[model samples]
Target chain A: MSGRGPSNYMHIGHLVIFEFVKWLQDELDAEVYIPLSDDEKYVFGKVKSLKQAYVYAIDNALDLIALGFKKGKTFFFVSTRLSEIYELSVTLSRYLTFNTVRATFGLEGEGVNSGVVFYAAVQAAHILLPTAKKGLLVLVPIAMDQDPYMRLTRDIALKAGFRKPAAIYSKYISGLTREPMSASKPETSVFLIDNEEEVRKKIWSAFTGGRPTIEEQRKLGGNPDICVVYEWLKVFVFKDLKNMNEHAYKCRSGELLCGECKRMLADALIKRLAKHKARKRQALRVIDHFFLHEVEIPSEIIKILE
Target chain B: MSGRGPSNYMHIGHLVIFEFVKWLQDELDAEVYIPLSDDEKYVFGKVKSLKQAYVYAIDNALDLIALGFKKGKTFFFVSTRLSEIYELSVTLSRYLTFNTVRATFGLEGEGVNSGVVFYAAVQAAHILLPTAKKGLLVLVPIAMDQDPYMRLTRDIALKAGFRKPAAIYSKYISGLTREPMSASKPETSVFLIDNEEEVRKKIWSAFTGGRPTIEEQRKLGGNPDICVVYEWLKVFVFKDLKNMNEHAYKCRSGELLCGECKRMLADALIKRLAKHKARKRQALRVIDHFFLHEVEIPSEIIKILE
Candidate 1:
């Protein structure tokens, strides 16, 4: 249920993950705990100052809040301020060795920082936090990139006398340009904070699997397989394959033009983002409601060491 | 200023370091800060449980207090209990990369654990704790084994806009058997808690420079240079070169018997340890006075980041 603390504003890519988490919570009647790793971002060299990272944590939390999570059911914490979690991280770090982390992360050399190495333990703490309740089935909805961390968490959690928390992996949602979505590349992704005009502009210039010429596209047909806009529709707009199959069929048969697809996505994104923008404004007003005062370790887990 | 947390009972080997630390505090009028790294010991696989490490910390602290460090000028903390230190460690851990720690610690292939690797940051936090006050000169008196950590601490402290801590290195005091003193080889070391009978037995079996036969020793003189008794006498009992020279001369001339030298050292040690033992019992009654509630991060250091 935890998400990485964004060093910058989160884009639509992050929104998709939050949406899935919300769905899981509604379906299973689950509670979510999100730890904001501002300390981590500073240690990872992502932000120059801890204050800057702290601000990002707040902004990112607000973004999640704007996604319409139930206030009482969701809790957020910043790592540096949470001493209990840091202490737990120390305990978890002991269960793992340097070779295991290096092997798990493919960081067998000089580039990794001690902070980054220690962060694996902090991440593991997040995974096992719910197990304090014992028999609480925890389902982590994460992107495919986080699978390695999940594997490490599962291994260490079992060793520390906790149930193996399950990980539900999802694919990476590509950028508007069909490249990896990164905060550093502003043009490639649609930010949650992007205005209607900005969203339209980004989608209009996005990468699509259409032909170079309009006449060629009509004769040879267009392809939606590699289209970022189509992928967005498949992940966010359509819930069933029936409508998705129709869209793809029409796209491949040249009945749906690239411009028409782009217009449809842009309109839907604008409508969705406008509602999210309003919710974000509301979230900023009640930011304090979502933060956890302190993280509680389960007495059952504490008794193991005792 | 920074001392490692003791993992087991403090032996006579640790007394030498305490004596020097007491001398430095008096000579330089310096404040002493010692962090008990029970976490480090657990991470290093020295102790099975943190509770065991915690008990070692209490016993070790009593030993240090027995050496006569003034309460007002001294402070002690266990790493697991100090959240401020853990926070500071995260800040410092980010300044250097994994390659830096690996290169500094000679951890080429990585049999080391994550806790031990992260402890480098925890250790660094201890070094820089005093810099909260502007322009404080920190003098760390440690054995040769800790030089690598001191070097890393100094580098990170300077980079973090603080004074580079100065280290005063001392040689390791060998065991009675002439090997490095370790808790693993309990027979080789004289524990502070050892009774008079135990001390006498250990000393009586200790290595010396005397020849196998009295007739051989009378013809070819004993070599005091390789004698453990002479080394102990040189390091602990006798400070003056004149007195040391007389002892060596007596051994070389075959004027001193191995039995006589062992008896002399045992008596001196038993007397010294008895006094230390009495003070240690008294120290346990006032252990709380030496613990720091929270290590204050100096306003000057905070301003640098601000």
Candidate 2:
């Protein structure tokens, strides 16, 4: 299962992991659960409000649905929209504590984020919810930095009367500048919504394996190891070893120029995203097939809302 | 409005506040909202499990419904059963901080109760939920010790864009032993469900202001000021100045014997509870008139429970 924080727009950085999830779905015939942490983004103070996060979450869901996940197999929801998540979170929170959260997340002594403190349990609940529903093995594909939440969920799973959810860690995807990709920073990442020209411009300006001058690049060859374009090329352009190896060899032997490589990466991204944008527009019509619209909350209790 | 934590049976200590709430309901033509904190009881570690707390909460609701709160004007719900409370809580939690909660609740450095930490926000949500529904004046009939929750709600009221709920503090209702009444200890509290024999036995052994010897008590008179029986008489038996003052006068002047006064208190309690138990039995049939049944949780989302 996989989820994303909807504090920012879905960008290429997000697509790298989503592509992995899609591949898992295809190979294993896996059922996918994507729970957007709209509640967390607001509680963690990442967004101005839960509404704003939810708005972004809906858009992100469209982007994910556009990625060609199986209709019956994929279940998409945001945290607040799915009542079971909150119920499960409160149930799991019985085994969680403020001290454990503080210590695990480095929140000790700087005590002003109770929502965040409780949110750790919410994160744990996200991992174990599938197990809570049925007797099944739940596996999460997560980045290394988020392993703590998975570890905490695993530690308390049996105690909370569920199977311990397993996790496979993924490496972080760096930005074009070799730093972590930030959704809020537009220049550091390629957005899924960015047009072909925007994609080309961003790719052309992207960091690459190149020397100070053409003569030096030809003499010393280029350094693919430090090239951001080469890194993304491995992720986006070439999935096969033969094509990937050929591109790397050309860059290292000074047979391929940085401009030509950038153009290749840009063309690949434009073609992929153009198809994605078309599917995203189509995803809007069939959103109900994925979203959770009903829950356990009693309706008669509403007096003023009417 | 007033609510009792359903970690234990509905006892006399709880009745003191509920009776006051009933008075407010009668005098002000007010809308009553009683939200049993089933979530807090488990999160606060007061109950063994959320299920246990919910079981107790449902029974407590029956006891409360037996008290004859105006059917249409009164609304009763437990935390988890009402999806709207959790939604509002997440919205309000944005304004609450860990530092503020820790310092405000003396939870600083004691990291292990993230549920309790967030449960504070649930408490605020309960207080503000009525206000969130409409432009209404909310007055909570709370015991003195629980004022911190009220204060916290008020502090964040406008920041969350709701009217600040008002509060009228009730003095602590001490147990038969002159300590705070605890539902966990059956002897200290007279549960609404307790039979006549149990009520009589408890009151007979209850603490009193009588002298050690009969001759000394007659010579100096009993001190009604410290008498648990007399304290309860003011709440349960006497609703007027003449009877209350006359009872106190008799005790102070040695006209009312300790045994006789205990019998009076016990009889009053037995009579009151007998009627309450009968209504509670009847309340079972019309429970839907009070309990919140349907909510926002979509049925399609419940994959495993089916």
Candidates' TM-scores?
A: 0.75, 0.88
State the lDDT of candidate 1 residue by residue for A207-246, as single tens digits.
9989998898888888888888899889768779999999
lDDT of 2 by residue, B1-306 (tens): 676787877787787788779888999899999998888888778888777877777778777878788888898888877767777788888778777887787874765577887888888888887788766768999988898888888988978878888899988766898877877678887987677889999999889999888888788899988999888888888879899889888888888789999998998899888787778777766767776554222232122112
* Displacement of the residue A138 alpha carbon in candidate 2, Å: 2.0
Each model's DockQ score: 0.44, 0.51
Query: Model 1: runs farther than 4 Å from truth?
Result: A39-44, A49-51, A65-75, A80-104, A108-114, A132-137, A158-162, A195-306, B66-73, B80-122, B132-135, B155-162, B207-289, B292-306
* Most accurate candidate by DockQ: 2
Residues A58-126, model 2: lDDT tens digits: 788888888888898888877877667767788888788776787788875754566787888888877
Q: Give the distance in Å from residue A198's predicted Cα in candidate 2 to where it truly belongs.
A: 1.7
Poorest lDDT segment (10 consecutive residues) of candidate 1 chain A: A297-306
Q: Model 2 captures what fraction of native contacts?
A: 0.60
